[model samples]
Target chain A: MNISAKQGERFAHAGLALLLLGLLPLALGPYWLNLVGKYLAFSFVAVGIVLAWGYCGILSLGQGVFFGFGGYAMAMFLKLEASAPELPDFMVWSSVEKLPFWWEPYSSLTVTIASIFLVPIPVAFIFAYAIFRKRVSGVYFAIVTIALSMTLVVLNIGQQGETGGANGITDFSTLLGFDIINDAGKVAIYWVEVVLLLTATTLAALLLHSRFGKLLIAVRDREDRVRFSGFDTAMIKAFIFTVSAVLSSVGGAMFALQAGLVTPSLIGAVTSVELVIYAAVGGRLSVVGAVIGALLVGFMKSYLSEHFPEIWLFFLGGMFIFVVWVLPNGLADLFRKILRVKA
Target chain B: MTFRRGNQAPRRKAVIPAAISIEETFVTFGIFVMQLFNGLSLFTILLLMALGLAIVFGLMGVINMAHGEIMAMGAYTTYLTASFIEHHLPGLMGVYLFIAILLAFAVTFAFGYVLERGFIRWFYHRPLDTLLATWGLSLILQQTYRSVFGAQEVSVPLTTWLSGAWEPTETIQLPLNRIFIVALTILVTLGVWYILHKTRWGLRARAVTQNRAMSSAVGIDTNRVDALIFALGSGLAGIAGSVFTMVGSTNPGTGQLYIVDSFIVVVFGGVASLLGTAASSFLIAQMQTALEYLMSGSMAKVAILLLVITVLYFRPNGLFASKVRA
Candidate 1:
C-alpha cells in the first residue's frame, strides 16, 4: 500500500478507538466514571508530553506547572463561588480576612477558563523562546524544565493563604452552577471529560497530519539540518511547546472541575515525571497510545494502592525499569508489531 | 585583634559612602553585612549540593533528577546516626556530628554506586530516559524512606559547640551552625578541586567527561569512571544533607526543597566547571537570601527564578560553561 493509504487506515482505526472511548462512561459505574475522568485528565497531559518531548525532543519535566496553573484557576473560581456567603474554610482558619489580588480574577468562570489556556501558553512561549534560542537542548533542557517545576511547587507551598499551601485548594462546592457533590453533576462532568478527551485526541491527530506537523517531525529528527535548510527550528519548537502547555492547562482545569480541588502535588516534579512516564509507556509516537497508557496506569494506581499501598511504588518502579529495558519504543509499538504480524 | 585594627579602620571608612548621611550609611551597611553573611551561609549548603550534581551532570550529561533523593538519603542517614548516638552513646553525641556526616556520605555514595551500576549506566547517553528512570528511582527511594522513618520530620540533635550563636550585637546574632556550614563548604570545595585537578583518577575522569569515545579508545574504563563520578556526586549531596539537618528539619520529602535551587546553581554556575558551580551558588544564594529578607519567601523565590531565567536568556551555556560543542 502507498503512504496515503496507510495514513487513511490509521485514521479509520483512530475513529473507531475514539468511538469506543466515548461510550466508556455509559458502561462504567459512577466510581469507575470518576476514575476514568481522572484518567482522561492525565491522558491529556501525556499527549502534551508527546508533543513537547516526543515530537520536539524537548524533555520538559514541568508540564505539571501548566497543569497546576489550570487546576488552580478553576479551583479558585469554584472556591469563590462555594464560599460566597463566607470565606473559604481554610482561608478563614488561616486568618486571611480577604482574598489575595491574584485570586480575585479567578472568581469568574470565563476568566478562569481563559486563564487555563492563556497562562500556560505565555509560560511555554517565553521559556521555549529563551531556551531554544540559545540552542539549549538535550540534558540542559530537561534540567531547566525540572528546575521550573521545582520553583513552582515551592512558590505554591509558600503562598499558604492563596494556594492553601501543602493542603492545596480543596472543599469546592460547585462548578458551573451545578452542585459538584451531586451524583448527577459527577456523571455530567465525567461525560464532559470523555468528550473533551476524544475531541483533544482527534484534534491532535489532525494537527499531527498537517504540513506543519511534518515540519515539526523534521525539526525533531534533524534540527541543525532543518536550520541549514532555511527553517526556523526555534519558532517551530516554541509553537508546539505553547500548544502542549495549553492542552496540559486544559487538562488541569478539567481535573479541578471534576475532583473539586487543586494542590501543590498537582504541579510538583513527581507529577511532571509521572506525565512523562505515561507518554513513554503508552507510546510517544501515537496520541492514542498516550490515552491508553494513562488509563492503564491510572487504573493500576487505584487498584494497587487499595490492595497493597506499601508495595505499589515498588511495582511501579519495577514496571518502569521493565518498560525501559524491554519496550523502549513503548507499548503502542508492541501493539503495532502484533497487528502487523496478524495482518 | 592585631589584624582587626588594620581592617577595622578601613572598614569604618568603607562603611561611609561619602554621599549618604550617617543613619542611612549605617543602616545600609548593616543590612549589607547581614545579607552577605546570610548569603554565604546559604551558599555553603547550595554549593555542597550543586558541586556533586555538577560533576555527574557535567561529565555524563545524565540529568539525575534523583540527586535530591540522594540528598534525602544522606539526611536520613544523619537522622539515624543521631538517633543511634542518643540511644547508645549519649556522652559521645557531641562528636557524633562528624561521624554522621561521614556515614551519610558513605551510605549515599554506596546507594548511588548501586543505582549507577544497576540502572543509570544503561541510560548513559540518553539523558531523557535517565531522567524518567531516575525519577522512578526517586519515588521508590522516597516511599522506602517514608516507610522506614515514618512521614514526620526527624530532628538531628545539634552538638553544644554548634548550637549557639555569636552575638555581634543585640539585634544581630549569627548561628554557629551557619558558620560551620560555610567553613565546611570551603573545605569540601578545596577537596573537590584537589581531586578533579590534581589526582590521576581526576585526570582520567576529566578525560572521559571531555571525550567519552576517545577516552574509552585510549583504554580508560569509562563505565567505572561513570560510576565513581556518580558516587562522588551523590556523596557530596549526602554531606549537604548532613549539614542541612543541623539547620533545618529533615523529612521524607525535604529533598524536594533543595532540588530546584541546586539545579539552578549548577546550571547558572555552568554545568562542567566546579569553580563555576561554587561561584554561581554564592551569587544565587546571596541574591535569594537578600531578596527573602526584603520580600516574602514566595516572592523572593519567584524573583530569584526569574533572575535565573534572565541569566539563562543572556548566557544559555551558563555563567561558566565550557566552550565545547556537542
Candidate 2:
C-alpha cells in the first residue's frame, strides 16, 4: 500500500514546519539554536534514509561518506578563506608546502557547493548501480556500504597532510569573509540551515508523492515484478540512492557551517549506521518524522551522554531493539496509531 | 596509495656494496618471509572470524552484527580462564591455554544458543532488521564488557612455550605465538569442515540451508539447526578470540576492529562458499601485508578497502559464488 499520510496528516506536517522554522528559534538562545542546527544537519541524512530505506528499499549504511564529502568540501573552501595566502595549519604541520590539487577546486564557494553533490553523487550512483544491477539487495548492500564508509574513513585519516588526519579539518573562523564562529553568525547560519531543511523536506515529500515515489515503493516491495513490468529497477535504485546522497551532502555542508568542524569520525562506519537509526526511530516512511527523530534522538543523546555517560550507550542500544521490535515504523507510526484511536 | 619516499631506501641501498649485495638480498628475503608470515597469521585470524560469520549468514541469512562482541566474549573468557587457572590450578600452567580455548568455546557457544533463542531467531527473515538488532546487541555487549572489565585492555599471560621466536635460518625468525595461532586456525578450519560435512547435524544444517520448507517438511527441525549453526559459528569466533590473546591484547572494543574486516572476508569469499571465505581472507591478508610494507598502516588499509570495493563491483557475488537458481 502507498503509506504516505492521508488528508488529516497535512495539518500535522504544517504544524511541524511552523514549529521548526518560526516558533522554536525564538525560544532557544544561540547555543541551543546552533545545537538544533546541528541536529537539522543530521535531519537531512535522516530524511534521505527515510526515502532510500523507508521507501526505495535501498538501505545505505554509508550516508556518512556523502555527508563527509559535503562537509569536507565546504570545510576546504572555508579553510582556504580562513588561511588566505598561507597553507592550512594541519598541512603546515605535515610539511605540505604546496596546495594539493583537489584542494584547489574547493577554494571557490561555487565549486565547493557544487562539489558537495558532484563528488558524492557519482560515487554513490556507481556503487549503488553495480550492486543493484547484480541484484544485491538487503544485507549485502548494507555490508558493502559499511565497507565503503570504513574505506573512506581510512583514506581520509591516511591523507594527514590534506584531510587533516585524525584531528580533521577545523579551526576555520570565517565563511566568505563572514565571521561564522560568533553568536550572530551562528544564529544566522541556524536560520539558513532551518530554511534549507524545510526546503529539503518539501522536496523529499514532493518526490515521495510523485509517480517516481510509487515506483520506488514498488521497487522496494517487489523488485522482480517492477522489472517484469519493463522498469529498470537498478536505475531506479541508483537514482534514489544518488538523491539521498545529495541530501546527506547538503546536510554535511550545513553541519560544517554550523558545527565549525568536520572529522574522520563523521564518515566512519559507526556514524553511518547511527544515521540509519535516526530515520528508523523517527519513522523511516515519514520525512518530517525522520527530522523529528533526528532532533529528538540528537537531543536525547546529548542530554543522556552528558548526564549519564554509562547509561547512554545502553539506552541507545536498547532503543534500537525497541524500535525494531515494537515500533518498526518509528514514533510517527505510533502517533498515527494514537490519532487513529482518537478518530 | 599516496606516493611517499620513506620505504624506497632499502632497495636503493641494495646498489651500495658488492659483497653487501648478497647480505642485502638475504635481508630483503628475510623481510619478505617475515611479512609473509605476518600475512599468514593475519589470514588465520581473519579466517577464524569470517568462518563463524559466513556459516551463520550462509545458513540462516541472518547478519549478526554482534559477531565481534561474541569474539570479544571469547577473548574475555580466555582472560577469566587464565585468571581462574592461575588461582586454583597453578600446576596446569602450560595446559591452561588449551583449557582456556575449550572453555571460551563452551561459554560463547552457550551464549550464542541463548542469543539465538532470545534475540536472533526473531529477525531471521528480516535481514536488515537482524543487522540493526544485532548491532544494538553488539553495543550492549560492548558496554557490558566495559562495565565488567573496567574499559582497559586486558591480556592473558603468554605461557613460556608460547613466547620467543623460531629461527629456521640466519636471517629469518618466526614468532612462536603466530605459528601456534596458525596451527590452531587450521585445526579449527578442519574441525568446522568435518562438522559441517561429516556429521549428522551438518547434514541437517545443510538441508535447512538449501531448503528450509523442505527440510522442515522432512522433520529436520530447522529452528534447532539455526540455533546449532549459530552456536557453532559463535564458538568458532571464541576460539579465534582465544588464539587472538597470543597475538594482541583484548579490550572491550577489539571486536569492532574485526567485525567489518570479517564481514569483508565473508562477502569477498562469496556468501555460500566456505572455501571462498578462506581464500578471500588469505587474499586480503596478503594484499594488506604487502601494502603495509610499501605504505603507512592506514594507507594500506585504505588501499585494501578500495581494492575490495573495486573487485566487488566486478564480482558482486564474490570470488567463489556458488551457482544457484535465482
Candidate 3:
C-alpha cells in the first residue's frame, strides 16, 4: 500500500482502538483508570518522539528534559495552589521566606500553560540552533542532548530548596480549584488527559501529513539535496525540535497533574533514553507505532512494578533487547508482517 | 588608521611595562603553577575514563552509555577485594592492591566481552539503539548493585603507601592518590600507544576500525577484533573505576557523575583520536578546575561548556578529528 492509504487504514484501526480505550474507564476500577491515565501521558511523549525522531530523523535522547520542564512548571503551580496562607510544604521545611522570582509566574494557570509550551520550545530552539547550526548530526547530536538532560538534572538536584531535589515536587491538594484527592476529581483528570491525548495525536497526525512534514522527511533523507534546494536544514530541524519540545512539555504537564508530583528523574538521561526506546520499539516509521509502544511499555511498567518490582528492570531490559534483536522495526512492523503472512 | 597605528605603538610599549610589576608577575606565575597541577590531577581521572570511551565510541562507533557502569563495577570489585583482604589476609592487604586492580580489570573485561558478544555485536551500526540498550543495561546494573551492595557508599581501603600527602610547603600538599593516578595514567597511555602502534592485534584492530569490509577481505577476523577492542576499552574503564575509589565514594549511582563529562571530552577531543582525546581532556579539565577555583562549581561548568561550544562552532570537526567518514 502507498503511504497515505496505509495511514488511512491505520487511522481507522486507531479510531476503533481509542473508542474501546475510552470505554475502559467505565468498566474498570480506579486503579486501572489511573494506569490508563499514565499510559495517556506516555502516549503524549511518544507522539512528540514521532515528530522529532520518527519523522525528522533526529534521534533526541533527551525528551525527558522537556517532560521535566512541563512537569516542573505545572508542579510549581500546583504547589502554589496547595499552599494556603503559608508557603508550600517543601519550601516551609527548607525555610524559604517568599516565593522565588522564577516561581512567581507559575501561580497563574495562563502563565503555567503558556510556559508549558514556551519554556521547552525556547530551550529546544536555542539548543538545536547551537547544535544543528554547527551541523552536529547523528550520535554527536544525541550526546549533546543527553548532556543537556544531565545538566538539567544536576541543576535541579543542586537547587534543592527550589526544586525539592530528588524528592521532586509533590503533595498537591488541588488542581484548578478541584480537590484532587476526591474520586470524582480523579475521574475528571483522567477524562481531561484522554481528551488531551486524542487532541495531541490528531494535531501531530495533521502536522506530519502536511507539506512541511514532507520537507522535514526530505531533509532527513537527503540533507545535501535539501540544502541545494535553498532550504536551511538547520532551521527546519530546529522547528521540528521546538515542536517536539512543546508536545513533550504538554505531556509532562499532564503527567505531573496525574501523578501529582514532578522530580529530577522525569528529566534525567534515563527517562530521555526511555522515550527513544518507546519510539524505536513502537515503530519509528509510523505514529500509531509510537502510541502502541508507549501503551505497552507503560502498562508493563505499572503492572510489573506492582507485582514484581525486583524483576521489573530485568524485564524492561529483556524487552529492549528483544525489540532490537528480534523485531528491529518494532511491534508495529511485527504486526504488519504477521498480517502480510496471513494474507 | 595610519595615524592611530603610529600612536598606539608607544601606548602598547608603556602598557607592557605597567602590566608587569615584579610582585604581580610572581603572583601570576604562582597561579599558573597551581592551575597546571590541578589540571594534571583532573586530567589523570578524565584520561582514565576517556581512553576507554574513545576506544568503544571512536573505533566501533558504539556509544556505550554504560561505560561508566563498567567503571562502577571496577570500583565495587576493588571495594570487595579490599574487604576480603581486610578479613582474611590481614597483613597482606597492602600486597593485594595490585591483585585487586588486576581482578577488577579482569572481571569488567569479561563482563564487557559477554555484553559485546551477546548484545552489542548486533547493534554495531545503530549508535542510537546501542545508547538506549546500554542505558537500559546501566539501570538494571545500578538497581542490581543497589540491592546487593545495600545503596550506601562503600569505601575502598587504600594501602599505607597510597595514603597521605606530599608536601612542598606548609600550605601546599598534594595527595598520594592524585600522584598515583597520574603515574597510572602515564603507564596506561604508554601501554595503549604500544599496543595500537606496535602489535599485530593492534594493526588488525586499526584496520577494522578504518574499514571493516577491507579488513575482512584481507583475512582479519573483524568480529574478534571488535570484541577484544570493546573488552579492552571496558577493562580500561574498570581500572579508572578502581583508581576512582581512592579519591571518592563508591555507590550504585556514582557512574552518573562522570558519564556526561566523559562524553563531552570524547566529543571535544574529536571522536576516534586518542591524542585528541588526551589533549581535549587535559584542556577541559584544566579550564574547569581553574575556573572552579576562581569561581563557583556551577559557573565553572557553564563557562567550560561555553568554551566547548565556541570551539566546536569554529572547528566543527573538533580539535583533532580524523579525516575518515563518520
Candidate 4:
C-alpha cells in the first residue's frame, strides 16, 4: 500500500531536503555556516536512525561508536600528517622512541581517506550480522549498541598510547595537505560536510521508497508473518543496520574535520542517545525530517544555552517527553497539520 | 589466576622468620579475599538497583528509563534528611539514618505512584516509547536536582553505629557499612519475594503479568496492581539510594551513572525473573572486580561489556530466562 506513497514522498522529501541544503551555505555567515556543518554532521547519524529505527525497527544507540571510529580513522591520518617525522603527540608522550605499528599505515593519504568509509562499514557489518542473526533485537539491540559505544569510549581512554586516551586525537593542521585551520579550509570542510549529509539523506529516502523498504516495514510490524512468508529477515535487518552505521561513520569523520578534534565524549552513551532523540524529534519515519531535526535541536541547544543555560536541560528533557508521548511523529507531523490548515 | 607461586615462595623463605608457607598463603589469600569482599559489596549495590528494574521491566514489561533518576530521588531525599537532622535535630543524628531510609522509600513511592498513573500506565503497551519518555523524565529530574541541590555531590554523615568494620581473621577486614548493605539486600529480597508470592496483591500482580486480559476478565484490578508494583519497584530504588549515602556520596547525577549498569544487570539476569537479576548482578560485579585485577580499569570494563554482549548473543533471553507469551 505504502509502496506508491513512499515513491512520491521520497522525491518530495528529497527535493525539500536538497533545497534547504542548497540554501544554507549561501544564506548563513561563516560562523553559523561552520556551526551548521557540525549539526549537518550529526544529521548523518539521524538519517541512519530513520533507516534503521524508522524503516527496519532496529534502534541502535551505538551510532556514536561508529562515528567516533570514522573520525578517529581520519584523525590518525591527519595527526600523522601534522606531526610528520614524529609519532602522534600522545604516543610520543607515552614514551616510545618509534611510531606505533598501527599508526604507520594511517600515514598514507589513500588508506586514511578510504578508512572513512571502509573502517565503519565492515566493523558495523560484522557486529550487525552477529547480533541481528542471533535475533537479539528491539530494546536488547539498543542496549547492546549502547554498550558497544560505552565500551569504545572506555577503550579509547585506556589506550592513551594509540588513541590519545581521555583527551582524544587533536591538533590537526591539514586534510589532504590542505591547511584546515584557516577560513578557506573550514569553508571547504563545511561544504563537503553539507554535501555528504544531503547525499546520505537522499540515499536514505531512495532506500525507504524501494521494494525492500516495504518488506522492511512488513517485517517490523509482523516478524513471524514475514518469516512465514519466506523472507530472510535477519539479513535485511543486518543490511539496514550496517547502512545506518555507515551513515554515522561519515558524520563522525566530517565532525573530526570540522571540529578539529575527536573526543571519547563523542562516542559515549549520552551522545548516542542524543542522536536517537534527534531522530525522534525530527520524525523518525521521515528521512529529511531527521536531518532537519538534528539541525533544529543543535540550534535550539546553542541558542537556548546562550540565553538561559540553566533552563536548557529542562527544555531538552521536556521535548524528549513531549516527542515520545504526545507527538511520536515529531515536527514533520506538525508541518503536515499546518499545511493542511493552510490548504 | 596469579602465576607468582614459584618465585614468591622462595622469596618468602628469605624474608620471613615465621612459617613462610603459611605467611605466603595468607598474603595471597588475603588479597583475593579482599577483592571478593569488594566484589560482593559491588554486587549488593547492583542487586538493589537491578531488583527494581527487574520488577518494572521483567514483571511489568515496561522499560522505566528514569529508574536511575528515581533512585537519585531517593539519594537526594537521604541527603536532605541528613542535612535537616544535622541542622535541626542534632540529638537524632544517629537515629535519623533509619528514618531517612523509610522517608526515601515513602517519598519515591509517592512520586512513582503519580508517575505511573500520569505517564507510564498510558504507555504499557509500548515498551520502547516508555523507554524514551522515561529518559526525558530522567533529564527533567536531573535538572530539577541540580536546581535544588546545586551541582556538587553531597555526602550524608555516617551514623556512628554503622561506621566501623568487623575482622573475623587477623588479615581480612569487612566494613560494617558494606555488611549492612548486604543485610539490607537480603531483607529487601525476602520482602520482594514475599510481596510477589505470598500476598493477595502478589497473586494479582502475577496474574496480571502472566495474562492481563484473562486476569482482568476474571475480576482483577490490573490498573491498581500496575501502579502499586511500579511504586514498590521505585521504593526499592529509593531504599538503595538511602543506603548509597552510607557507602559514598550523592549528586543530582548519581542515578545516571548507575542506570546503565543497572540495565545491564537486569538484561544479564534475564528479564521477567527476579532470581535472574540477583544471579546476574553478582556474576557481573564479581567479574568486573576480577578483571580489574588483571587489566587496567577501562580495559576491564571493555572486556566485561564484550563478554556480556557475547553472552547475550548466545543466551538472548539472559542467564535465567522466564517462559512467557509475548
Runs with alpha carbons beyond 4 Å of true place in candidate 2: A1-4, A341-343, B1-21
Please identify model 1 stretches exceeding 4 Å from their true place: A1-23, A83-115, A157-167, A171-176, A341-343, B1-34, B85-94, B167-172
How well does candidate 4 score on lDDT at residue B62? Answer: 84
Q: How close is every model to the real structure, measured as TM-score?
A: 0.88, 0.96, 0.89, 0.94
**lDDT, candidate 2, B1-326, per-residue tens:** 11222254355556666567577778776776787788899999999999999999887788999999999999999999999989999999898999999999999999999999988888776889889989998999999999999889999999999789999988899988888888888888988999999999999998988988899998888888889999999998999899888889999999999999999999989987889999999989988887888788888888888788778888888999899874
Q: Model 1, B287-306: lDDT tens per residue? A: 78767876788778888888
Model 3's CAPRI class is: acceptable
The lDDT, on a scale of 0 to 1, for candidate 3 is 0.82
True contacts kept of 1: 0.66
lDDT value, residue A228 of candidate 2:
100
Q: After superposition, how far is residue B49 of candidate 1 from its true place, in Å?
A: 0.8
Interface C-alpha root-mean-square deviation, candidates in order: 1.8, 1.2, 2.0, 1.1
lDDT over C-alpha atoms for residue B95 of model 2: 89
| lDDT, candidate 3, B127-207, per-residue tens | 777877787788788878888997899997778987898876544567787888889899998898789889999999999
Q: Taking the candidates in order, what DockQ does each have?
A: 0.52, 0.72, 0.41, 0.75
Candidate 3 lDDT, A1-343, residue by residue in tens: 3344455546545763565355687687776676667677877788788788777889887889888888899989999888866777887778888878998898899999998977777778987877788898988888877877877787787677788978999899697788875777767888887777777777777788789989989987888899999999999999988988888888888888878788898998878887777777887766777877887888888789999887887778777767767777787677666555222
